[model samples]
Target: MAAEPAMQMPSLEELQHWTWVFGQAQQMMLEQGLDMMAHMPGPAAMSHLFEPAAAFRATADFWSDTMTLWSRFLTQEPGAPLGEDAEQARDRRFRAPQWHEQPLFDFLRQSYLVIAEHMLKGVDALEGVDARHKEQLRFATRGFLDAMSPANFPATNPEVLEKIVETKGESLLKGLQHMLNDMARGQLTQTDPDAFEVGRNLATTPGKVVRRTPLYELIQYTPTTPDVLKMPVVIFPPWINRYYILDLTPEKSFIRWAVAQGATVFVVSWKSADASMKDVTWDDYVEGGQIDAIDTVRDLLGVESVHAVGYCVAGTTLAATLAVLAARGQADKVKSATFLTAQVDFSHAGDLSNFVDDEQLALIRSLSSDGYLDGRYMAATFNLLRGRDLIWSYVTNNYLLGKDYAPFELLYWNSDVTNLPAKWHLAYLTDLYRDNRMVEPGALSIGDTPIDLSSVKTPSYIQAGREDHIAPPESVWKLTEHFHGPMRFLLAGSGHIAGVVNPPSSGKYQYWTNGRRVKSLQTFLKGARETKGSWWPDWIAWLRGQDGQTVPAKGERIPGKGKLKSLCDAPGTYVRMR
Candidate 1:
C-alpha cells in the first residue's frame, strides 16, 4: 500500500479570512430569513415578529440620527459631535489621530457604534431563548462587530495611513514582520522583552527561600523595620501567574510595604506544572500547600497564629483550607483571613463564566492531554474578554503602525504565564465555576473532610475591585453571607490586579466603605462613604489592631533557623523554571 500523503495546514491569514467569510454568510442568511417571515400574511407571523420589528425600529432610529449628523456636517452647520462621549468608547486605540476629528473617519466610527448597539439590543430583545444562550449570543455578536471595526484595517485606519505616509511604507513592512513573529509565537507581543530582567529589575524586593515543597516555595522577605508585629503574614497568590506580581519592584511591592509596617511577611511562590505533577488535586493544595505554609510560619515566628492573605483563585483555596482546619479543631491557626477580589459564589462571575459551560469544559479537557492547560491558551481567553484593549490594540501598534511595545511592568507580569495542572483545573471548573459548590455546606471536600465556609468563623477582611471583570464586586460580596465571623468589606476603584496592588504612596485611586454590614451589595454601595486614597493604609491599620502586641524584631532572620530548612535564595528554583 502507498504511504498516506502529508496534510497541509492553513496560514493564520487564510484562517482569519475564512472565518470572516463564514460570518458574513451566516449574517446574510439570518437577515434574509427574518425579512421573509416579516412579509408573511398571517396573525401568527405578526405575533412571532414582535422582537424583530422592535429591532428594526431601533436600527432605523439610530441610522436616522446618524444621517442627520452627516447632513449637518456636509452643509457646514453647527451640529453635535459624532463621537461626543469618549468614555462610552471602550477601545482606546480608536482615539488615535483624526478618528474623532476628521469628518469621514468620525462618520465611519459612529456608524460602527450604532450598529454594535443595535446588535446588542437585538440580542436582549430575543424572547424565547434562555439566559445562557442569550449571553452567548451577545458575546459572539460583540466579537464579530469588534473584528469588523474599520480601525483594525490599515487601509481604513487614519493613524496607520499617516504612519505609512510618514515612513514611506517602511513602517508597514516592519509591522508585517512583527505580526508574523507574533503569529509564530502564538501570542501578542504585549511588551518589549529585552527591557526587563526578572531578578534585577522586576521581582527585586530582597528576600530568601525559607522552605521548598513539591508544589511551592515559601519566601521570607527581609524585615525593613526595627520592631516587627508579633503576628506574621503569609500570602497565597494565584498560581496562574508568578508570585512576583505581589513583589514587582520596590515602590509597588506589597510584601515590602507590609514588612516596613512592622510585619514579618512570607509568600508562597507556586511551581509551574508539567506532566510529572498531573495528579495533584485541590486537597493537596489546601492541606499540603496552604496549611503547611501556616505551620512553617508558626515555627519560624515561634507564634501560634498568623494573618493569612490570598489573592484571586488562591483566596478561594485559602477559604477552603481554613474550613478544613476548623473541622480538625485547629481554627486558631489563622488569626484572621483577607481575600482580594476572590469569589466564593460563582453564579455571578461576570463574562468569564460565559465560557464555562459543559461543551467548553469538555473541549478544555481534550486540549489538556499534556497534563496541563497551556499558559498561552489561558492568556488568549482573558484577552478575548477585553479584546480591544488586550488583543487588537497590540495588533494595531505592533503590526500596523510599526511601533515597539513599551516596557510596562504590569503587562510584563501578565505575559509571564504558568501552566495549570490538568486534574486541578478540571476540578476547579466542575466544582466552583460550573456547580458553584464552594458556597454550599458540605459540597466540597479536602482530604477526608467536607469543607464548609460557614463553619470556619474566622474574622475576615475582603476587598473587591469595582471594575473587575474576572471576579465582579457583586460576586465578591456574597462572601459576607458565607462567613459567620466579623466581616469588613471594601470596594476599591480599579480592576483586579491594580486594585489589590494599589499603594498609598501613589495617591491615585479611591476606595469605599460603609463600616456596616448589609444584606444586599447594592444597598451596601448606596450607603458607603467614598475615601480618597488607597485601601492599603486602611488594611494595615486593621491588621495592627489584630496583632495583639509588639515584640522585638528578628532582624534579617536566616531561612535555615526554622524546622523547614532553606532550599535556595529568594524567588526560589521553581520561579526560575520556564
Candidate 2:
C-alpha cells in the first residue's frame, strides 16, 4: 500500500475557539447523553449510524497512525521527536517535556491526539442527525476521547512516573490522601479550599448590608472617594453563585475598583436557596432580586434612580426586569444598565444548548429531591464545561503529581456554590434555554407584566467575553437589537469571569469596541479596534457619562452615621450560606 498524504488538520485557532468547555463538556455530554438517549427516542441516535464510510476511513487512519507511532518508537533514535513533538501540541495535557523527549511517552501522546482528531472529524462528517443531537454526540465522543488520554493516569504519564520515582512512592501515598480528602468534601478540590473565606480574606471590601429580603440582601460598599456619582450603582450577580466574585480581593475586586472610581456600589447577595425556599418563582427573583435591589438603592440613598449592572444569569434577568419595568411604566427607575457577559438571545448559545431538552430537563428536575437544586450539582456541571482545566488539571496536580493546588482567590470563589429554587431553575431552563423566549417579545412575563424586550429602552453598556462559554459574543450581540436604547457592544478578551473581573492594575487581556451596529459578530470585528488592558476604565467612564452629578459620599464609615442604618458588614449574611 502507498504511504498516505498528510491528514488535513483543524487549525490551532479552530481548536482554541472550542477551548472554553471542550474537554469537560466532551465528558458531560457523553454521560448525560446516555440517560437522555433512553428518553429521547429521536433520529439523533441514528446520526451515529450515518456517514459510516467516513467513520470507517477515519478509524483505519487512526489505527494506521497508531501502528506507525508504535513501529517508529521501536527503533527511533533517543531524544528524537516521534513524528511530531507532543510538547508543541496546543493541548496543555501534553506540555510536559518528558512527553516529547521520551519516545514511549511521545508515542502515547501522538496516538491519543490522532485518535481524538479522527473521532472529532468523523463526528463533523456525520449527517442525518438533527443539528442539536449531532453536536451532542460530537461533544460526548470528544469527552470519551479526552478522558482516556495517557496523561490522566500516573502509570502512563511520564511526568507522573518521574514524580513517583523522585519521591520513592511517597507521592502515591499523598495522592491517595488528597483523593480521600476530596471524597470527604464530596467534590473534587480545585484549590486549597481552606485557604480563603468570605469577608475574612476573600470578599474583604469594606461595605454595609443595607437591605435584606427573603430572596436577597443588598450590600452597599463604602465610598473610597470623598464624592460619589449622583447615580449610584446596583449590581445583581447570578444566583447560581455568590456575589463575592465581583469583590474577590481588594486588588482584583471590581466592586472595590468601582467604589474607588467615585461610584457608590451596591451588590445583590442572593440567599442560597434551601427546601424552605422551594416555592420561590422566577418572578420573585426579578421582583425581589434585581427590582428589589434597585428599589432599595433608591430608597436608602433618597435618589430617584441608579445605574444598574447585571452579570451572567442576573444579566438575563436584569433585561427581563427591564422589560417588566417597561411594561409597568417604570423604566426610568434604572438610569442606565450594563450587562457583563450577559445574553438576551439564546439562538447562538454554543455547546450549552445540548443540555436543555424535554428529557434532560425532566431528568434534572427529578434530581432535585429538595425544593431547590443543589448548587453543587450546577457547579459540577459547570466544571464539566471546562473539565480539562477545572477538573482533570486538578486531578493531575493534586493526585497524579501529588502537589498542592496554589491558593487562588478566584478558584476559591469558583468552588463556592449556591442552590437554585426549583421553580426558578425549571422556568429559566424551559423559557430561556429550551424555548429562547427572551428574544420573543411577550413570549415571557414576570408576574403579570409581559417581558417585551423591545420595550426596554434603557441605554445599555453591554460587555461580552469573546471566549465566554456561558455567553458567546454572537449571543450577546443579539442583545443589541432587543434593547431600544443606544448601546455599546464590547468584545473583551478571555472568558466570563476573567474578562469582566479584570482590573486595570493587573493589566491583562484586551477589548474590542465599535460605535456603529453591525449585522454580525464577524462584521463587528471588521470595524472594531482592539484596546489593550481592562474594560473596567471604559465602563467607569461610561458610568460617569450617565447622570454625572456627584454628591458627598452618603454612607460614612461610622456604623450609625449613614443615611441608611447598616444591617451588617459587607459579604453579608446571605452570601455566607452554604
Clashing pairs in 1: none
Clashes of each: 0, 4
| Per-residue lDDT of model 2, residues 1-578, tens digit only | 99766535445564444333333443354344434433435653453454557756755665566556555655563433322445335678888787776655666676566556655666677666668877877766766666777778887899888889889999888988999998897888888877898888889988888777888887877777878888888898998998888988788989888888888888888899999898898888888778877886787677899899989988998999898988888999999999998887888787777778787788778978788888887888788777778888888889888997789988888888888898879888888887888888778778778888888889999999988987888888888877888888899999989988899998899999987777678889999999999999899888888788898864443223566678888878998888
- Candidate 1 C-alpha lDDT tens digits along 134-170: 6766776776666767788897799999899889999
Off by over 4 Å in 1: 1-52, 62-78, 81-86, 89-91
Please report the candidate that would top lDDT against the real structure.
1
- Tell me the RMSD of model 1 versus the true structure: 9.2
Worst 10 residues of 1 by lDDT: 37-46
